[model samples]
Each structure stands twice: as C-alpha cells, then as structure tokens.
Target: MKLTLTLVTIALSINAVFAQKTNPNYDPELATELKADDYGMKTYVFVILKTGTNESKDEELINSSFAGHMANIKRLVEENKLIVAGPMLKNEKNYRGIFILNVSTIKEAELLLQSDPAILEKFLEPELFLWYGSAALSEYLEASDKIWKTKY
Candidate 1:
C-alpha cells in the first residue's frame, strides 16, 4: 500500500512538470503581432541582392548608388517592411546583399524594391523569392534591442 501511494505521488509530480511546459499562459497581443500560424510561422519575401551590369563603372555613380542603397535599407527597416538585410562575405557570383521583407506577396516586394535607388540605377539587382519563417521574428526585434547597443 505504501509503495502504491509513493508511485502515485511521483506520477502526479511528473505530470505537473510536463503540464507547465506544454500549457503556457501566453499573451494574446503578442500572438497576433507574431502572426503565429498553426505551426507558429508565417510567410515572408526573401530577396537576393546581386551585382548589376556595372555599365557605368564611374566611381561617383557607384558611391552614390551605395549611399542610396543603405538609405533604402534603413527606410524599409524603419517602416517595418523589411525584417532582415545584410551582405554576404564573399564576392562569389557577384553576390552583394540580401533582404527578407515582411511581406506575403512577390508583387508587394517588387514594388518595395522599385523605390530603392540602387535598383533604379541598375547598380544592384534583386532576385525575389517566397519564404516561410517563424512569426516570432517580429517579436524578437524587441528582445534583440536588449542584447545590442547600436541601432540599425
């Protein structure tokens, strides 16, 4: 009888432990902001930045285009339309930069790219694709601020 009672107590304790991990009291606002799907993910637009024709080759034009490129990225980030943007370390295949837009449609992403001066000047080109990623990416932005001191 004592063994049966001890076993029952241990089983209840184990069940309680698992319950806390599985059933969390989540915030509704955050769930919506993340756009959590059934699997806690959503769609995004992924863009691959590549070297353009480089027809001009003029140093001034290149510099100006790059300046505009950075500014465009900043603008997208500020607007919350772009979630991730960065450059690759290697110049392989003329790969330059990348962007993950917080958009669901390719048409929307294309329009956003059109506003970039680099694209306008043909100094940088983009290859757009669709991506499915964690919706929490948006929420992590706030958490990231705690780890990084600089903005941008």
Candidate 2:
C-alpha cells in the first residue's frame, strides 16, 4: 500500500510540472497593459459595504443618498477605478455590497469611497482589504456593457 501511495504521489508531481508550462496563447502586450505580474495577477482593493450605525427614519434622505451612491458607482467605473461592484444577497453578516477597486492600497480605496454618498450619510460603512486576482477581470466590463438591455 505504501509503495502504491508513493507511486501515486510521483505521478501527481509529474503532472503538476507539466501543467506549469508557459501558456501557448500568451500575449505579452495585453499582460503589460493589464499590469499583470508573472502569474497574470494584480493587486486590488476589496471593499465590503456593511450596514452602518445610522438608523435614520427619514425616507427622502435615504433615497437621495442611494441615488447618489449609484451615480458615484457609475463615475468610478468610467474612471477605470472600480472593476467590480455589486450588492450581496441577504446574509447574516449584514454585508450590503462589495466593490473590487483597481487599486493596490487601502488608502487609495478609502479615497475612492469618500465619493460615495451612502457612505457619507452613514447609511453604509466600508471595510477595505488588499486582494490579488486575475488582471483580466476588467475586460469583462466591455462585454457586460454590450449585453445589458437597459441602463439602471
């Protein structure tokens, strides 16, 4: 049994080495434009928008703030600073949404978040973290723009 396990491990190791070979479709120019590292990944700032301490009963203020938040999102996307932004489904952690910013530092992310009206009004609070993900992620926005039937 031990000999069989050793043989299996050796086989897996050989497969891993073969899998690490350079991609046949590698595009150096695209990688450079996306700021991808050797592994085709880049640093980003991940933000979790959580329910804030404010419990304002004023509906008009809340609605206006959210409208401004949406506008801010649009501006950030156009600026190429926000690569991903979406609301989370109902969850136990009180997380309202998320934003994956095309930035390397928490400070930069904080500066970007300052433009969000919901955050300013204390309707939503942000928690930022450094994230590493595929540099090609922003490419999806182009295709996404084509598929949307209506603007929200």
Candidate 3:
C-alpha cells in the first residue's frame, strides 16, 4: 500500500512538471509590464534579389521617399522593435539588402515591410521572404546586434 501511494505521488509530480513550460528567456513580468505578453521573438528575413527592372525602380523609390522610410525605421528602433536593415554588396549575386525583424511571425514581418514607402513604388513588392527554424539571421545583423547590445 505504501509503495502504491509513492508511485502515485511520483506519477502525479511527473505529470505536473511536464505540463509546465520552461524557458529561461521568457520573462512574463517584463512582457506584462510592456503590455506585450502575447508577443514572442520571431525572425523576419528580407532577401534582395537581382532583377533588371526592380533594381532601377527600387532605387528611384528609395531616393524619392528616403526621408519617410528612414523616419519609420528610426521609430521602430526607438520602440525596440527594429532588428536590422542594410544592403548586400554589389558583388553578391541574386541577393541584395536583408532586414531581420524580430517580430511576431512571418506574416507580421511581411505586413510591416509592406509599409515601407519604397516598397509601394510598384517595384518587386519588396521581394522579401520568410525563414522558419533559421539557424541565425545573416552574418551582418548577428555581428551588428552584438555591437548594438554592447553599446546600449
């Protein structure tokens, strides 16, 4: 009878433990304080592709609305939302600028990027893509983020 009770207790304890999720970085207190308890970290990857027409149109769009787009990016940075954005070198083929957004999901990132004024210039639709289960944001932001956190 004692052994049966011990086994039952152990089983109940195991079940309880399994029911709870454990992740060190998940700070409920911070999330609640910020009023973003429902949000979690996600990767937003923007891939720049080489297209004859899009390259030129994108350049014009960027030149035309550089002020507005930059202001928006700065705001996002102030809000602790903007991850990183920059263009790949000219030498690189098929890919150009990549912006990594630590946002809600792929869809959320897409929606956010769509707000980019330069993107609305009838170009290649911003020509971005979503990456799931990624090993890491491209090498640039990884290095930049490290430097960023160190500075601030």
What TM-score number comes out for model 3? 0.47
TM-score of decoy 1: 0.76
Show model 3 residue runs off by greater than 4 Å: 1-62, 92-94, 123-152
lDDT of 3 at 141: 48
Encode model 3's per-residue lDDT on 1-152: one tens digit a residue: 99999999999999998886666787777555433434433345554533224456455556765556667676766655556666567674545456666564667767676766555553334555664423233334445656654531
Error of 2 at 115 (Å): 0.7
lDDT of each: 0.85, 0.96, 0.57
What value does the lDDT take at residue 46 in candidate 1? 92
Model 2 TM: 0.85
- For model 2, the stretches where C-alpha displacement exceeds 4 angstroms are 1-20, 150-152
Any runs in candidate 1 off by more than 4 Å, and if so which?
1-25, 143-152
Candidate 3: pairs in clash: none
Q: How much is the lDDT of residue 107 in candidate 3?
A: 74
